[model samples]
Target chain A: MRQPMTALERVHVTEVGPRDGLQNEERVLTTAEKVALVRALVAAGVKEFELTSFVSPRAVPALADAAELVAELKDVEGIHFSALVPNLRGAERALEAGIDSIVLFVSASQSHNAKNVNRSVKESLRDFEQIARALEGSPIELRGAIATTFGCPFEGNVDVRAVGNIARHFADIGVRYVSLGDTTGMATPPLVSERIWHLREVASGIEPTLHFHNTRGIGLANVMQGLALGVDRFESSIGGLGGCPFAPGASGNIASEDLVYLLTEMGIDTGIDLPRLIEAAHVATRLMGRPLPAQVSKAGPRLALSDCSAVPTARG
Target chain B: MRQPMTALERVHVTEVGPRDGLQNEERVLTTAEKVALVRALVAAGVKEFELTSFVSPRAVPALADAAELVAELKDVEGIHFSALVPNLRGAERALEAGIDSIVLFVSASQSHNAKNVNRSVKESLRDFEQIARALEGSPIELRGAIATTFGCPFEGNVDVRAVGNIARHFADIGVRYVSLGDTTGMATPPLVSERIWHLREVASGIEPTLHFHNTRGIGLANVMQGLALGVDRFESSIGGLGGCPFAPGASGNIASEDLVYLLTEMGIDTGIDLPRLIEAAHVATRLMGRPLPAQVSKAGPRLALSDCSAVPTARG
Candidate 1:
């Protein structure tokens, strides 16, 4: 077998920590801190940052300052600022806040959708269509998100066909990108590959980005399988923050710093600098006042000896 | 790509938690407790168990009771009991303890060998040859282990050819099985596959088993990659016990319960029951006075509706 390509070879990482990560934290970050975190990530050469969500304050009080945070960071350059929008109202809010892109989420599992948004899967699809229609011809790039694409907390095994149907529908509705979310961290490598393959088959030429969680501690493994399937785009939170509030027992998203370390070490080109990302992880960990679930943050990078010690020290 | 076979379909798990795991803990488990843990694992359908090592007491004081423990459980049927033997003396001791199967460890990295066993790689190989020759033509089966096959803690980025050379040397010395150990948990899926492929090329017809550590938390992912490569036998510790005294920064070996759970859930065949393994984990945890590193132990098996109250009612 040949050596696989590094992140720089094919994939582009989209950092979603500031928005998706803090949106679920109990101690809500102030708008200033959120903006500062986003600025720090930008300084670290992160090209894509999901800033915040446009959901109702009651639903995600942690992100109530989404508009303010985006407004303050309006001058940051070289970063695509995106926001998660629940529906047309969310899309309108995001558009008004000057976000360059909007991400709409639809649950692949019907029971998950009913519990999360109080809507059936079809109802959520209709909402996504409406949001897509509302953003027609706008500068904002409308991206669809299929949450719980691997397996559902409410529904045991999610059919890959169901996920593909949603992806095909989104593609038909003119959505350019679809992210398959392992919302409850229920995905293993097999599940991740199966779903990605199904989506690739159904929506030929339209590749969906992968979003994984480390709740069950297999996030990096899932990422490897995704990479093997030729997926080049991924959504990850810095410091491994982010989880669905409606999904019980869900933990943080796959940490961006850890993901970058894995990719860069594999000789994959992820434009993000690992040391800078690690510095950002320190900031996030301090802000959270607890350890984040990032493996790289806890365990340093897989560095070469020249990079590690530089001296010919005797082995201990 | 086809779905990788489920854990129930392809793999047989060998629980190494008793020997490799307890050897690294600060507190030493009594010989009775170690025997009980092994008996519990056997009861849980573990076919192979690495009971203990015959190393000097000064080196690994935790397993000083290897002889007594083996003597206590001589009548356990349907289980293969193996022991780690470092050199000719250790091999003799293991044989005296009635252990017909023995695992000999040799470091692939010269730096690691110098640090770990105070011998050069060549010296270690010479010692391995002596041990293999001594056991030749007997009912004893000697297996050679190439440590740090993927990446080394001291050397960093071990060459796959070097590992293959060591494995080939072992094959020449009448060793039937060669096990590749990721001594430092630094391997990714790609690295795992590459090493397995190289080992297969170098040592044809000698079935290789994989020993992975979850220190950096990608153990199962590496296992998945190995499974895809047609490797069927693996070494795991109950409740993720085991650490390398030689590998300073390394963490526990991959958790047996978690590995079994991953395999069984994926429909692979380990022939081990998870709940019973968890019970073994509980015994080990109680002995250790802290929870071990098994992921499935902390977070139960990956089920869709674990918390659903209606499941019991519906089943009734």
Candidate 2:
């Protein structure tokens, strides 16, 4: 059997808690609190962030202050900030905010696309084209996010060809960074390998980002599969902030601190400080006013030793 | 890269919820409740179980009724039941209860062994000799469990030679099944591969079972590592019942439903029913009167569809 990739490989961890994690939450955080969360992560050596989405305030009240949150942290140095954009208007607003990148999303499953964005997959792709045209000569980069790329909640087992077709559209528009979203936490190891294989064939030269949710509790397992396939980019939420509205109690995204801890222990560098990242997760938990789903934050790192006297003498 | 093991490979999932799970809980279940949990899993096609442990009632108050629980579950046909035994006396009790196997445990780290069972590692191994003599002509099989096989809380980073020497001792005593217990959730992918290699060199023909905790939320990830190495047998708890007493919010064993779901999705045959196992997890949750750490039971399976109409219109 082949050994795992050595410590020489660096993995990029994109923190998406402010955008993807907060959107599904019932409690809306203030712009200041969101800035605090982002600032805490930035101090933890986090370089990339999916900050917030420039969508209608009426649609996602939780992220109503997206632009305000962006402007609050505008002076943070050396950090790449990306925001979700639904159309040309959102893209233009992101440009005015001086965001690093604008990610245009369309679900691979048509039914989910219609339900989520109220547009067919083709219409969403068309909107992306308009956004791309608006940024033709701009310094900002264009990225594509294909939601429900693994499996659709409404339509189960999305075809790999659907993902490949969407990737082809993104690549055609000069979008090199495309993220495959497991919108409902339906991603499996085999499906991850299959999609990566399909992307290599159908959308060559486009870098793929694997964004997985831990709703089914195998999100990190899927990450291992991605690593084994030599795919390095990953996206996660701090403190596992998001919970799926449809599934009632299901987890949303894999926790950023937990992901960083896993990468660090595997000798894969993510350029993030694990202990400081855990403190950021604690900040998110405190602001959320509840315990987040993250384990490492609660458990501490593997070597965070306890006083032998502190442990109760019991059957282990 | 080599592909994952195919569907032709069968993995053995040993349900250890009744034994390792309950032993750590503060709330004690009635013997009938214990029997019910085992029967529910048996109905779910789980063939092997670490049903309970025959230890001193004073030492483990929660599992005080281990013998009674075993006797209640004796008539369950076609199921292989094992129990943890501390010494010759406990092993004799397990034999009277007609258990198929008795697992002898010692910590790879001497400090942990002393802290846990109030004995030296050498003393524990000597006790195993008496237990082996008690079962010399008996039909019951002997299995070995090495706690803190990856790392120790009191002594960080246990040497692989310690684990190898223990496995060698177990093999010398006519034991073929040896479980390397990640007692404190310190097993990483590299450590797992390293220890497995060590065991292969020293212990030779013993079948190794990988027991991991989700303390830092990477239990299933370790399982993927094990699968890639062609090791099939795994041990997990129902509903992730056990939590580390030392680490307040740390999860103990990986949830059985989540483990089985990952295996099934990977096209590996476990011969375990997913939905029924989930129902059993629900029973455990209800009995605990609090939510268990298992995610699959709460999220449902991947294909479990919701009425598209019931889904609230929200930003993805």
Candidate 3:
């Protein structure tokens, strides 16, 4: 039997297409296109979004409008627009841009951390103290992420303890929400559940979300595992577009429409309109100048009948 | 916590590449390539295979060698090779070819039945009675599949009672093994579990297997759902290649390598070598003249490690 979702009534989604989705694309979107994308997502009932990255323009040129984009949409009602900040300087920039929440990341695997951020995990965690102190007593919210928590390209089978300790340190620095990243797409269901269970034991103060890649095509299985643990927060791309090019995984995120189909079919409210999300995917595809990798968008929804009585069965 | 696998010491897999996989391809494989594919699967310790279909050559020209393929490999040791049959004539042909096992299918939806096999669901069920009578005293084992058990393209949501009744009738006709086909990839985890649970009571004598298509990208999640219910048998294709093109769904099966990756990671004994299966997938790609839709084949396996140590943290 499937695990009963008696305790879980709704699932929260963090639409990460603007930042994570565009970061990996060869084609960059104009600031206007970015705004349009975000607006469409907001119109689709997306209450949460990682609107842009606060990293250096030289590092992520695609999101050069991080500050301008946030400033333009700062007064948007009912939506939580968060930005990804790689350091205290990025945090300062995000705050200057009037961003209310920020996501900071450090890899659980040392090699990935050095390659991803040019720093070690310890250095990254130690540097968190500065960001924590900087944000002390501020209205801004901080969420931490541990990449390669499931598996690593350089270090295979990352010990859950390493990710747990990093998560624990994020908690120590007053971070409340954290996510375990499958940067290299090494997440299986059992592995996902195992790490989530480890988090429950080691860092109960932190609310854990999951960021999965569709590299080997078990992203939803990992999400389902998180759901089994009553974890409903998922980070996904709009058109299922994106992956860290150097992340040792395939370039695909779990599609918003795909995840929405699973969520809505199970009667778990995502509050985002699935068809509108697919429309958002079409917008993303046009901007990226390539077809995205999402399944539901291309194949149509699982049950797409408008009038059941009008549908013709093949009996004739 | 992940589900325990105490009772599920071993799981059975039916490799359906030769029939289901090739049937949906534009490039029809030569008998030698087909034989080589099956040989590689056998070498990788695959103990069961659906080698071909007894459907007419006009219907599925790719599998015109139904008898030829079986006749070539019938003497192979220690593997259960099954052939799909549409009617008693096909069943007789399979038995004539000395096929040890045969699979017959009837869609649970009337529209799908009309389109797929040119009969109503009731007509298909009634015809199964003739196939049953013809095979009653034969050595050939019989299994039944209920297509569209989850949902129908023409009929939006297939009632569990409707599918349960089909499964019960299959069991009544002395079929001990029944598979539920996600013909249009309409299976969510909860829907899969619900239908599977109902099958447990209505056809307690029947061993249920799942045939999933990765049309909407939750195929693996559905498989994990079946795994949670202790349903150990699954039908998958090589390289995620194959689907009924006419079947109102996408063109990918849950890739054998991806499935093997999940199974081996969970300590589920599939008895097949995962890496070797991937190698076979490469061979399949070469034969198909184009890459198939499976992610693992192109992205490669999940746990890719190049260096064992010396990964530096982000700190200076």
Compare the candidates by lDDT and give the number of the best one: 2
> Evaluated with DockQ, which candidate comes out highest?
2
Task: State in Å the error of residue A151, model 1.
Answer: 1.9
TM-score of chain A of 1: 0.90
| Model 1: lDDT of residue B45 | 88
Candidate 1 lDDT, A1-316, residue by residue in tens: 4376434385688988877687667778888777778777877779987777887787777777878888898788767988888778788888899998888777888877766676777887888888777778889888778887877777778888888888888888887778888776778877877777777778974668888877666677778777877788998998877654443333468889878877775668878898888888878888878766565665566643322111111111
Q: Clashes in model 2: which pairs?
A: none
Q: What lDDT does each candidate get? A: 0.75, 0.87, 0.79
Task: Provide per-model DockQ scores.
Answer: 0.24, 0.50, 0.39
Tens-place lDDT per residue, model 3, B76-169, is 8989999888887888898999987888888888877777788877877888899889778899999888888888878888888889999988
lDDT of 2 by residue, B38-87 (tens): 88898899999998878778777887887788788767888999988877
lDDT of 3 by residue, A167-248 (tens): 8998898889997777767788778878888889999999998988887777887787788789979999887878545433
RMSD to true structure for each model, in Å: 5.0, 2.5, 3.6
| Candidate 2 residue lDDT tens string, A135-233 | 899999999899988899888889999999999999999999999998888999989999999899999969999999999999999999889888989
Question: What is the Cα-based lDDT of residue B14 in candidate 1?
Answer: 75
> Candidate 1, B294: how far from true, in Å?
3.0
Ranking by lDDT: 2, 3, 1
